[model samples]
Target: MADFAWSLGSPSLRLGVTGLSRAGKTVFITALIHNLTHGGRLPMFEPWRAGRLLGADIRPQLHPDVPTFDYRGHVRKLTDARVWPDSTRQISELRLTIAYESATFLGRSLGRGKLDLDIVDYPGEWLLDLPLLSKDYRAFSSETLERGREPRRTAIAADWLAHTSGVDPLGPADDEAAGRLHELFAAYLGAARGGSLALSMVPPGRFLMPGDLAGSPALTFAPLDLPESGEAPRDSLWALMESRFEAYKDVVVRPFFRTHFARLDRQVVLVDVLAALNGGREALVDLEMALGEILGCFRPGRSSWLGQVLTRRIDRILFAATKADHLHHASHDRLELILRRLTDRAIARASFSGAEVDVKALAAVRATREATVRRNGESLPCILGVPQEGELLDDHLYDGKEEIALFPGDLPDNPQALFRPPEAGEPGFDALRFLRFRPPPLEVTAEGVSLSLPHIRLDRALDFLIGDRLA
Candidate 1:
């Protein structure tokens, strides 16, 4: 009862937006802001559709310590330059103040409603480190080493593993050795993330996207081969590495959780499911495991100890498969189904008491339009757009200026087929003929008024994330 009063008196919500690299996090944020500020069409967002939403504008962020989200700069890049904004490399915050009319009779009698929507944007790579909070140095080392030895990862992990075999855990600490190990390990992680591997379990995320802590000792350490049950010798390499790992969790991971994550009221996890699908069964399963681990960090139920300490919980979590524009509308539902299946275990493990969970296929900035192409007397559903230059399809290279129609293949009717390993002489899963597309040119009126960014179901996402608050 007291909490309800507090919420009503001070209407504020912190929304956390996160996703792996190339998952459209930056574009999503920019499009969302542009649509709301410009009074764009949002039929699915009840607050906007019902005419209760009066206005929404950017205000100064509440936290002075954190850098402001570069809304203007990103808008310029997207609107003026017609190019996508760069991916988020660090933490940033933005506050959107919304004015609305009250829905209830009593509230309407009182006056207009207002809400401070604080949006926190951060790298999803950072969330990968949360599982490290409970893991000791030896446990982390053993798990990472085991993963490195997996068949799919062996090729990429060879250089790092070769170096690991030569280093003695109990030998004297050497800065050069540590640096070399860190570099090799970081390179392996980068390789796994690139192309079709799409591995998501890489930790000490600073190593991969080290913003300001590039060369710091806390980020220099890598997992080493150590005995199953033993203590590290005093001042030995193992001991030094262990200490730095703890420091990273203490100084880097914990602060992020305490300051930013703990305060979030809602969250949107963007995913590039198409990329994983293209990678094959291994990448899909790895992505699922990674998402499960990340979801476990959320304090879902009020009975949890972390929930008690934080005094707030993430009451709603929306797992969205981004870049839906790459596929035809006919496959959108299947895409959503795949995402739901991918997150099923994580959603169950979270067991968020009184929390709502949903999955959707959305394109923050739709880059394609629906079309039909005729081939062999059959009309095939296709998406027409300008593929980025050098994007190859069927031995043809796109020049970036030519509009082409692409028939992105269909997803399986039963998403369960995605989990099975491929049989001999068979492609693992139904691979989409996906290609990156340049942002669509904006529409403008004769009077020089530009329209809001076009999107696929973005308003529905807005409704799921914040519609209840406005009411």
Candidate 2:
């Protein structure tokens, strides 16, 4: 018999599952926990595969709320139905413990250990904004301005852009003007959040709760005043901007960074690259810009004395292209190709600092495979998967057609593309085409786990985050 308490002597790993809105954070968390504890149908997730995973018992104390997160029921719902709508709300604090056999530590023989995984299932939208706390208002506005001009979008941003352009780019940081812009900016951001713009900067529900300072002046003012103006007045929007910027850094950014981002042993930056591609050329551009800007918050390229003053605690970063099950098996590489293009700037900027950077195409759920629909005998790259639930998920027929135009749900209408493709191969892929994903089995084996990995990536993520404490 395994020494349950003795195995408890090992350190528990703290994992934060973050991704863009609709990027599958909840489903992933649910599937991960369900598979880990119940050994239900799930993709192979290493440690779990070694089979020595003693039967896991999930108690309310470890996980606290169970009804709020009916993981098994959610999986059943998605798999049973022919179609599963995307997740719309944010659910928080779902924890699960997995007991498994681990390789011996140093001279010790192999024995069982418990992975007390505490998972935070947040809206990917809010998680993506973690990097935004670093930027000042002026810089934020400047970046937002560029993103507002993408060709393939139509929304509040268009109107906001008009207002921003009319505001003298070189004018003083007038407080009233800045306040108006702030409201407009917040509205635009809220709209973007609601619209499905995949930009990493938009905070989840921030659109819903503009906070107590909703009608207040905008913070973080970079003077649009000419360089010749020298210094603007202290009471100007510039000062309000400065104050808010400081507050954001101290009040908002600092605590999150210290408690979560800083404390994390590893990170998974889930990018919806396929969704961006499906949104077409404009979506691609916006995705790149947002990703680059977000990554910039962590890298700190050239040290300002202030830059030296503030630093993020995240040491290792994993940029993953989520929803891999949406693509045909062959197109996985192509999906990665598109992801590389979107994140090239961010990756390059991050790699220089010696932080481990990896790009992966994955569907934590493993939804479907590429197949062809022969309605008119036209061969197209299509996705194939079973539609039944429980162990019957694969018992149904393969369905779906080539998505001519895919809506990335709520992304901004017009967004920027960060990188240009090196060259297009035989694949006549538009920026907006991608394979739709299917869910993984409720019960999976070690080999199943391996397929889910674009590489030994999860192990690497865990190692960086928790390996130091392994005994």
Best candidate, lDDT-wise? 1
Write one digit per residue (lDDT tens) for candidate 1, span 115-186.
Answer: 988888988888888778779999999999999999999899999999999999989888888889988998
Give the distance in Å from residue 356's predicted Cα in candidate 2 to where it truly belongs: 3.8
Question: 1-471 in candidate 2: lDDT tens per residue?
Answer: 112453355455546566666666655555455444544432243343444456455543243331245555665665555244356354344446666555455423555666665555544444445455666555655565665565543565776666666775445556668667666766776666444454445542233333332343323222232233344356655555656655655654445444444444455667777665555455567667667755664566455332454434455666677766655556566666667667877777666464666666666565554455555765555555543323212243334422232221222221222243334342222433333433433433667642221211233334344444333
lDDT of each: 0.86, 0.51
Residue 171 alpha-carbon offset, candidate 2, angstroms: 13
Candidate 1 accuracy as lDDT: 0.86
Output the TM-score of candidate 1. Answer: 0.94
How many backbone collisions does model 2 have?
Answer: 41
Worst 10 residues of 1 by lDDT: 1-10
> Which candidate leads the pack in TM-score?
1
Task: List TM-score per model, in order.
Answer: 0.94, 0.65
